[model samples]
Target: MVLELHVWGPAFSLPSIDPKCLAAIAYFSQAVPKDAWVLVASSDPSVSPTNELPALKNGPTWVSQFRNIVDYLRQYSDGAWDLDSNLNALETADNTAFSSFLESRAQPLIDLSLYVSSQNYWQCTSPAYGDLLQWPNQWLLPPRIHSAAKARTAHLGLSALDLDAMEDQRKRDHSAAVAAGKIPANFIQRPRDTVSKLLGRTSHQSQFRLEALTGELFEPLEAMLGGKDYLVTADRPTSLDCLATGYLALALVPELTFPWLRDAMKSKAHSLTAYTQRMRHKCYGTAAVKVADAYPSLSPSPSPSHLPWQTPERARLATVGYTLINSLADNTPILSSIRAQNRLRQAVESSKADLSDVEREALAKHATGMKKDVLVSVAAAVGGVVALLGYMVQTGFFSHEGEEEYEEEEEEYEEEPLEIEVGEAPDAFGVMGL
Candidate 1:
């Protein structure tokens, strides 16, 4: 069977927008032969067991994350698929340590640049996510991921970079202040961000902090490379190379409004910059996905010419129902709890919300849309409750809060799953091809 290496769709002229996805691309390019597998831009986290991207599928077997995918491939192929098989025990240990270092240290920096920074997120990264995903998911996933990033990096003491909600509020306040009367350029008390006024986060300090983070990650990596083309060894690439490439390529490549991460990498760490560029080019060169229809003629690009990428399996129908139902179930409670417009803005930033509009008109529309969603969700939930209560009342099938069971009811569950075999799940349920 042809193996499916499912990942997020490409953006910014990169193989995949995600760093982890990039690592998988690099690993597949090096380890898996062109004939054995296909790359898929599924662009839906719901398709995976772990609810993450860069998943590998072989029949019923499903695995995700770069290191896990490496192990899965190696074991399934019975050692033939091993990328680190050439490394000695010591080298392998080093390989493991570096992978950990990359994920833990390098990841937060990427999050900061791509998701946490208000300007970068609003201008570049969020739009990329919107383009990469389909309808409702386009609205759902970006905010969720952005929320996750903010939580992950909260302790880093860079709250200024993360205040997208407050940023919009400040813009509105400043515009109102300006409309009241135009101020002179030389005026010392010009309208400024309230949060920034209180916290006093300067760009110079943010840059300095960013540079320090880059050094912490890149210094060790550069020291290890020591002028070599690849990390861990000079001759060829390893899984470590794939991970580093994934993390560093993302840090360097994406065009961000606040490009401190990219700037720090370029200005401070020359060696790392070169190594990431090299790995990205070698591994993700001219990468294209396979489709049923041909571009120029009716043939998928074959072999090493383009890395073997395939059209992704459509999202299962069950997934769509779950997403819609789940969104209503999840969002309404948060919406109901909110008491004020400021609190509502905070809810969008904190909860599994996605809309982050850069423009004033768009931000207003986004707020209105969010309010509508909340009302719709609340109505649906209330209607369902009313319907259920009516049925219970008519049939006398329910009891009061302190009432005992009407009878001893036997607990039951389906012995069989919704369907067997995860691979054919989309076919069994239904496929939503974009």
Candidate 2:
């Protein structure tokens, strides 16, 4: 028998239970054959229709507890189901519990669909959810990089409030409460201490600063995902995959409102945030009703400028080049020789120490050549890095000395010849083992 798995979280916001919510349910329900058993699991008790547990009465069951859902699902589908072990898989640490759940749910008889509460459906589907599939090689993952580092227009806004402002506001609120005899000075300090202790911070200032930092970083995240449904191979979606989209809606709202949340995200951490925003735009049709690419509707649309992922093509090209250079250095031998020629040309152009006309022209020609070479190297690099970045993005490898090390290595490599094996290659006739 086939088993369908559904995941739902508690209701707290507009995204908690909505069209995407229903789509998640239906999407997963249809992934498996009709003959399979269906199981719905929700952190929220009211996820099922008529407010009843599907697991208790329906042929397909609804389970409020994650462990119970795992137990029931394991019975009907051994190799077909793919679920994260945690009650709320998306909420688990580093998504490890979720990863374990997916590995367990893999079987031949179960077909999985997801009804998730978060907006990370795009990620959960491919690269993320795809990691746990019985045959992940069969799936086509989306673009792993979210273009966070790509060039684009910078529109600064007061949307971000500084730490000083937050502190002053808190102080003002505290003073007002104390003056009104609503609470003593110690009352405010007590909660602050409690929070500090719980969070493992020594002082309220440190904890609050951390919050402010997180908020600052995630502020630009919403703009990263304009509108675009991140499909898991355009049509099929596995369980926990849809949560990638759901997690976005959950994260975006909070990131927009809370400055600290933004600050908490750093570098590639922004990629996850960016991915969520892009997925929401894909599924929900921008900030407003999405007019289908094939249809025309007079719905109130979101601003064309207020897009989620709008990094320009040229910028994307540059980033692709940068990532390529880095990855090639790690996995290939030709990378060093190629980077040297490119860097030599760059040095000639940037050097303002003065040069004769002959030297200048020679340098100019060489730089021009390097630019073309860099462009080509970058293009070839794009393919390799896509695989690397896709995995890193999904598994959370954006943070580390890896990126920095890559940059330094590239810089050193730029001093070498960009063409290592070219002179060593035989004629186009492919003659001998020279």
lDDT of 1 at 123: 82
Candidate 1: C-alpha lDDT: 0.75
Model 2 Cα RMSD, 1 decimal: 30.6
Stretches of model 1 off by over 4 angstroms after superposition: 163-204, 286-305, 315-318, 332-434
TM-scores, all models, native as reference: 0.67, 0.27
- Give all candidates' CA lDDT scores: 0.75, 0.38
Query: Taking the tens digit of each residue's C-alpha lDDT, what string does model 1 give over 189-224?
Result: 434353334335555575567667778998898889
Q: How many clashing pairs per prediction, in order?
A: 3, 69
Model 2, position 231: C-alpha lDDT score: 24
| Model 2: worst 10 consecutive residues (lDDT sum) | 108-117
